[model samples]
Target: MPHTLAYIPTPAPATPFAVGETVEVLDREHVVLSVQTIKKVTRKKVKTDCGREWMLDGEWFDGESSYPFPSIRRKA
Candidate 1:
């Protein structure tokens, strides 16, 4: 049987994020991590810019399918 993957949305930005980009989920402090893209965007919605705004329903290395970071501060 073929394998199937579930979908989940990360509470981060939805538009400016890129594959293989390291970002910091900003809150009280900077929490840095790396991200890898697994699928293409299916749909999108413009939401608030508070913290979790740029991410979408996708897959990551954390064994979860979605943007996990709430608010990322991209590492430079």
Candidate 2:
């Protein structure tokens, strides 16, 4: 006899950002330039007047994935 394991599907995590929202980036304040949907995936574009910019995805901030980019937080 062979043993089998059950498979389950999980819901995608929610994003903590919104378009045109200001968030703290790299200890500084930045604005979310845009939120684009590409092939069913979400992408957030952030930038500062000093020319600091980045395009972030779920894996960058989600707990289940590796986070290698600067931390982002809601403006106080």
- Give the top-scoring candidate (TM-score): 2
Give all candidates' CA lDDT scores. Answer: 0.37, 0.38
- Put down candidate 1 lDDT per residue, 30-49, tens digits, no spaces: 34343322223224421222
TM-score of each: 0.29, 0.30
Steric collisions counted per model: 10, 0
Q: Which pairs clash in model 2?
A: none
Off by over 4 Å in 2: 1-15, 27-69
So what's the TM-score on candidate 2? 0.30
Residue 11, candidate 2: how far off, in angstroms?
20
Off by over 4 Å in 1: 1-15, 29-69
